[model samples]
Target: MIKPTEKPTVTLVGMDGDMLGTLRCVEKALSLAGADSEYLLKYQNEIIKDDLYKDYNRLLDVTRKYVNVRRLSREKDEEEREKARQQRRGERAGEDYKESGFES
Candidate 1:
């Protein structure tokens, strides 16, 4: 049996379309509201506000979604690995049985 730690690590980066749309709306609102701001300001505001600055509920929801996605992906990877391992075991067992003159 392969240890969990022996499995290759999977990394995922997800961006919610709704979250992106909300950001675009925010940017458009800011742009229409007053003088143009620096690109860095927009980027900083988006990151800080999403992760740290504001809307605790929204942050939790996004975090939950991200975590769920990663969890599902990892589960799928493990399932595939298990299936492959089982297939190899079956093949080896079949070869052993044949070598023992157990043909039917």
Candidate 2:
């Protein structure tokens, strides 16, 4: 049994036992099995909307995680840039002081 977290694709089984059209069926099955109905509904609004809802929430969570990772990367880049800027300023200051006849 695929967990609700799996985001498994739903496929309709035909009368001949062959697969029919896919319909986000997993979420619907979960809903029919008495999973979170309202949350699923709020997440999606189609047939087997609940199944789609579960997939939607899962996707949102993955997106949030990626966003956090990107934010951290930006912060690291800023820190590196600042460090380089500070080093350049120090080098310029040292040159100026040396040219002012200051002792080594």
Candidate 3:
């Protein structure tokens, strides 16, 4: 439910459960990030290289409702996992999942 934001954090949280919603949310986020469509396209071609844009299909995964396709990348995946591990070991006391950057 936490739509991805334009903050300078590692993850962009604006993905909706569905493609259409996700697109809209991502567009809004990009807009808020102060990027126009053309700028974003250029950035995608430059900053956001192909490695971070991997396409993953999860149509058979019943647990997922809002999303089926996702971007799979090893770097971000490991970083988030490590953060989660640290949180489990009690990094930030009384912090919620979102506050601890665990919501995806």
Q: What are the Cα lDDT values of the candidates?
A: 0.47, 0.44, 0.43
Which regions of candidate 2 fall more than 4 Å away from where they truly are? 1-72
Q: Pick the candidate with the highest TM-score.
A: 1
- lDDT by residue for model 2 over 26-69, one digit each (tens)? 34655554547664554344424334334544443432321221
lDDT of 1 by residue, 7-103 (tens): 1222232323345544444444444434255742644454576573356346434433322222225567678778989999999999999999979
- lDDT of model 3 at position 66: 23
Q: Which ten contiguous residues of candidate 1 have the minimum total lDDT?
A: 1-10
Estimate candidate 3's RMSD in Å: 14.0
List all candidate RMSDs to the true structure.
16.5, 18.2, 14.0
Task: lDDT winner between 2 and 3, please give it.
Answer: 2
Tens-place lDDT per residue, model 3, 1-104, is 23223332123233323433444444455556565677445534532354323331222131122223344356777787888898876844546655877767
